[model samples]
Target: MVDQSAPLPSVCDLAIWEPVLRLTPEDGTERGAGRSARVAGRISPSGYSIAHRGSMPSTARIAVQDIQRELARGGVREVVFRAEVRPDGLTTLGLVWPSPAVEPAYGSVNLGVLVLADGSLPAPWLRRPDPVPGAVPAPSADPELLERTLRERLPDAVGATEEEIAAAEARLGVTLSDELRVLYRVAGGDWADDVETAIRVDKAVGCEIFGVEHLFGIDAASRFPGWDLGATDAIRTPPDAVVQGLAGSPGWIGFGTNGGDVFAVDLTPGPRGHFGQIVLLGHTESLGAEPVADSLTDFVLGRLREERPDRRGAELPAVAGVGTGRLASVQAAAHPALEVLSLDGGDGPPFHLAPVAGLPRLRTLTAMPGALADPLEVAGLTALEFLALGVQEWRVLLDAGAVPRTLKAAAVTVRHQDHLPVVPVANEILALWDRPRIAQTLLEGDLGPAAAPA
Candidate 1:
């Protein structure tokens, strides 16, 4: 008889593993799986490895294909044929498996292999997906796959109805954004059952879908008001280098004064677009005239999505609250093809207005109604490329010494109702005004270099 311990044949083996779960099955009392059994610690690149223990079944060859598809849903990267084995009085067996990367684990683990020699491991006990090191013995040539990874695993919240979502899209004159679309479909208007669970999965283990808010068109500031969602926070708009850390956590996503104002949205839900829920705290009054989305939480998300890229050319969201403390406090950050910002204005706690260094390619800014008022300020926006402010707000900035050191171009017009001096100031500085459409005047020359009177 062929020795059964010869490592089996190369392409016909099946391997299984079960990751240790922190909690024991207490007679199905727990609502969800408890914490992972794997402890937390530094894991060496080569600390653990896995290999198959036996051969696969002959009749189950076709059945194995179905398993591959299901595993993909869980974000398994690759799968391939592993080995073949001949049980002593039993027929030879064949097995196939995936070549998943060995990630760090904190606790004890178990691996199993099935040999189908008339008396092999029984069904249901043959294989299971678990957190195991080097288990399943990766298949040699598995192709890569695309899957949505959830960053946070909070329980699912209530989803929007098809009709409700459609109305929102029409009212906004834009789509619901990609991620929101997915949530709408998956949630089917009822997702509270798995909202919290989903969040935990994202925060703890590596899952197929990550709840990154950055991926979607929605801005973190509007989606989650109250926290310093401005340039200070990381997840919504982290720098180029810190992007990876923002993608995962113990890091958080929010915008407010004390930090209790937390908000999180899933970025992957709207793959073809973008979508997720937004939580608000302390500043329910922050959301503007637009109606709230589904719930107050979702309302924030809907508004954020509206500001993102639309199907038509790269359209920009109208900036609301420009010159006032409202516009001054609106957080701004750089995105790949565009920028993400929140126009919600309020008495915010101190926060950063720009990245550590600065954003170089900012092109345009629009003002929403009531965005800019008498006390407007725009003195610090030196790197801005294009400036568009409500005409009335522009005068406020002019009155408050709102000066652009090097403005390449500008488009300022107070809204219809109010009227201010067409030309507020006159100085050599006025000559520096890039264009002359509204109030054109020549500066009176530098007055003793004291910045031309306040």
Candidate 2:
């Protein structure tokens, strides 16, 4: 019998070992039983905890049994078990398997076996770093100078009154971070050009900050009716899969848009929720609400200093000002190593695809639906591996063999007013792929993959 009076061992005290499935002759005889499955474990203050990743109830039970048998075989004794009911009503069993070989040291004992009982695992398991507390930004050397510089650099800079700021907070249901509130009081919300650009904080991760009009509660009036502000849908990721953040959340309050992309702040506070932190709700090829910055101040300052055009190579100047005219002048001075590029023409004008012919190392290109109308222009991009184009352009590219043979994947966006026949176009694209490929099509509101031909 175990001593119930003694405190439980901490996870750090144990030599955490992954649970590997071991199949004996008897286990092998069981239908659907295969070689051992490896379940990763994390260290907590109490003990090491292992959670089933999307395993079915039946499968989870088997895994737990396998782990217990393996431990017993290893000479662990006096194992205790407990079942925990999750909020969703699923029962997850927790085990306390002790290792007698390893003696206790530093007031900590060996935590041989432990399992997560109730709550979901922390988001850090997805490899997202914990939010580092950021210091308040001071753009210039002097505080007064920083204010003056901000006013001069940011066109249409206006300060909000204390009463106005308070009102906005009350309506939003979350207190704005002090640094962000100061920004609103100093420079107001909108910028002059209103050019939407992503502030890259991590690789393939960025935050798209919109113009001033979307700031504060300005967009609430213009928000789409389908946009739900209270939905807290957890992201569906495979157990062992690593991603940025959750996908759907009612806690996300939209503040701006980057083209069709929505940028919002997570108001819900907890392990998964970055309460008061700015998050980029997935809008394009990527999915999930990726936490961009610790606060609005971090995002704005990071955008101004780090994501500036000058910092990024001049090979792609079109990113600085995203317009059809700006894109036309973006010529690669040499055989540039530009891999990913997104061209947004907005409502201004259509982008000229002539400059892209110079990029020999271009891999992925995401542009306005109408930008790739002329398939011949992009056919010469032999290095192009992935392309995001409209359904009409997919037809044109397929018919003309304009899609590079090097292209391994593609995504087509179907517009609301698009009346073009999709079945034939989808068929043609599928026929062109000789090997295994990934082909996705964005229909009306769904950004899922279109079924491939058998």
Cα lDDT computed for each candidate against the true fold = 0.28, 0.40
Model 2: per-residue lDDT, tens digit, 1-454? 2222222332111112212121111322221232222222322323323333343345544544554454445544333232222222222223333322211111121121111111112211122223324323223223344354455555444566777677767766556655445555665543344333122211112344433234542122122111111011112322222222343334455665555767665554224333456665445322244555555544554542222111112434212233554533335322354545566656655555666675765555656566553656776566665565676677677777676666544445434313224333543554565322212121111111222223
Query: Which regions of candidate 2 fall more than 4 Å away from where they truly are?
Result: 1-321, 324-328, 332-335, 417-420, 435-454
Q: What is the lDDT of residue 123 in candidate 2?
A: 18
On the 0 to 100 scale, the lDDT of residue 362 in model 1 is 39
The model with the greatest lDDT is 2
- Quote each prediction's TM-score: 0.21, 0.27
Clash tally, candidates in order: 68, 4
TM-score, predicted candidate 2 vs. hidden true structure: 0.27
lDDT of 1: 0.28
Residues 141-242, candidate 1: write the lDDT tens digits: 111110022212223433346676676556434444344454443332432356765444323222223232222222323332211111111122222111
Query: What lDDT is reached at residue 203 by model 1?
Result: 35
